[model samples]
Target: MSVKKISRHSPPNCGARAASASVLALMALLGAAAQAADTYNSDRPGGADHRLLSRYQGSLLYMYGEEALGKADMLFDDKGKPVMRPVEGRISNRMYWGPKKKSPLEVYRNYRHALETAGFKTIYACETKQCEAGAVQDAVQDLPRKVVWKDSDIFVENTFNSANQPGFHYYSGRRTGPDGDTYVSVALAGGYEDEPVFGRVRQFVQIVEPATAELGKVSVDAKAIGGALKRDGRIALYGVKFDTGQAVLRPESTAQLAEMAGALKAAPALKVYIVGHTDNQGELQGNSTLSQKRADAVVAALSSKYGIAPARLLGRGVANLAPLASNDSEAGRAQNRRVELVVR
Candidate 1:
C-alpha cells in the first residue's frame, strides 16, 4: 500500500501529527471499501459537487495551520532586502487508501479526504481526468489535468505552503515585469498546475499561476547579463573564492565588466548608482567599508579598462547595512557580502 506523505521538511512529530490523525479518522468514517472510478471536475458540479470542495478545502486549510511558524524562519538578502527568485515547478501526488471497488472518481474523492485530513485548503476544478497543454489560466484551466499516472485531472488544492518550510512546493509561469525584462520564478507547491494518480485510482494536484514576463527559463549567460545590466544600473563586484569566507575580486570578475559595457551600449541615457552590501559578521563599519571598496573596484574596472564615460558611473560603499543571509550562521553571513546596482 502506498502510504500518504506529509510535507517532509519538518520533524515528523512536530508539525504533521495532527494532519496524519485527521486523515486516518476521515478514512475510517468513509469506509475503507471506497474506490474511485473516475476523476472529479468543477464544471460538472453534479459530477464532483460542493461536498468534495468542502472536503478538499478542509484538508488544505488544516495544513495551513503550521504556515505561521514556517514564515518565521525566512531571512533577507543584503540591504535587508528579500531575495526575489521565481517559481521553479509544481508537483503533486495521491494514493488510494479506501475500498478496492470504487470508481476512479470515488477513489480520488478519498484522496481528497486524505489531503483534507492532512490539512490542505484546496478547490476542485475539472473533476475529469483531462488537461490542456500550453499556457493555461483560470481556476479550472489549472485542473482537469491529464494524469499520466492514471490519466485524469482531479482537484486543485487552494492553500499555499510557506517557503520557509519543507514539503511545500512552487509553480512557474511567464509574465513581464515593470522593467520589461523576463525573469524566472519560484513559488509555493500547488502554485503551478498538474494532476497525478497512483495505486490505480487515487488523485493529487499541483497548481501554478501565470508568471511575470520578467521570468522564464534562466539564461546560460546570467553572468554576462549581469555585466550588461550593471552599466546602466548600479553594479558592484566582490572578489569571491569558492568555499572561502574572505571577499576579493578574482580573475573571473572581469566577465562582469563586459556585462556592464554591454548595458552601457544598450542604453546610453540610463543612469546608475552602485552600492555595496555585506553580511553582519565582523565590525559593521568595517563591513561597510569593504562593501564600498568592492563597488569602487567595479567602477575602476569600467573606467580604466572599458573606458566608459566617467560621468555615467557612480559608486559608494555600504557595509553590513545589507545582508542576504543571517549573521547567526556562517552560510547566511557569506551570502550577505556582495554589491548592488541601483538603476535610475
Candidate 2:
C-alpha cells in the first residue's frame, strides 16, 4: 500500500454558510408575504387600530348608532330586538375570509384569544353544534343587507345565505378601552359560496364613547348665514341637534333655529329649500324618512316659534344622497349630517 499523499483537504464552511443564507432568505420572503397580507383597509370610524390576523381579508360596514340588535339564541324570535343590547356610539360589522387551510374553529379561537389578550371579558361564545342555526341566521340578517364593496354588492345575497355550513362559531363580549367601553361580536362559518375550499368570518364591533358634547358657542349667527346665502346660494347649519335615530330636536338647538329665523326675517324675498341631509348610517329609505321628518320639524319650529313664513321655507329630506364629506369617519359624518338652506 503506497501511502500516497493522504492529505485531506478540510471541508469549507460553505455548507453551513449556505444553509444560514437560505434560512435568512426564507425568513425575508416570509416577512414580505406577511407584509403583503397585512393590507386590509382599517380606515373605519371610531378606531383604526385593530387586532386581527394578517392572513385574513377584511370588509367593513359601520354605522354610528347601529343597534346591536340580533338573536342570542334559538329559543324564540329575537327579531327587531337587540339581544346583545345596543351600542350608543358606533357600531361596525367587519367581514373576513381566508383559505380553507385555517379552519373556522381555528379562526374563532384566534379572535377569542386576541380579545382575551386585549383585556376583553368574554360574555358569550359557542361552537358549531352549540350555536343555534336559526339564531345565527337572525343575527346575520340584522347586518346591513346592501354594503357596496369596490363598487359592487358586498353581500351578493342574504348575509346568512353564505353561512349555511355545518360548522360555525359565534362570540360576543365587552371591553373597556382608553376612550370608553366597547362591545364585540364574532361569527365564523365554513364552506363559503357553496365551496368547501374557503372559510368566512364576521366581526361586529360596537364602540360606545361619551356622547359628543353640544357646542358651547354658536359658530354661525344670522349675519354669517346671510353672508353665506348672498355669496354661495346655500348655507349649511351645524348647530342644529337631533336625538339619535329620531327626528326630535334637542333643546340646545334653539339658538341655531333662532338665527335661522332671523336670517329669514331679514331677507323677506329669499325663498329657500330646507334640505335635510344625514350621515349614511342606516338604509336609504329609513334615512330618507328620518331626514324628511327632521326637516319638517325644523320648518314647524321656525313657523310656530320664530314666525317665519312657511311658504318661503320648503322642507325636503334628501337623506345621504348628497353627502358633504366621506362617511367613513365620525368627523366626516358629522359634517355630512347637517341642515342646508339652498336658495330656490
Model-by-model lDDT, in order?
0.40, 0.64
Model 2 stretches with alpha carbons more than 4 Å out = 1-219
Looking at model 1, residue 11 earns an lDDT score of 66
Off by over 4 Å in 1: 1-248
Model 1, 122: alpha-carbon shift in Å?
A: 34
In terms of lDDT, model 2 sits at 0.64
The best candidate by lDDT is 2
Q: What is the C-alpha lDDT profile of model 1 across 100-146, one tens digit per residue?
A: 23344543444455544544433222233121111112222222232
Q: TM-score per candidate, in order?
A: 0.32, 0.41
Candidate 1 TM-score, true structure as reference = 0.32
After TM-score superposition, the amount by which residue 339's alpha carbon in candidate 1 deviates from its true location, in angstroms, is 1.5
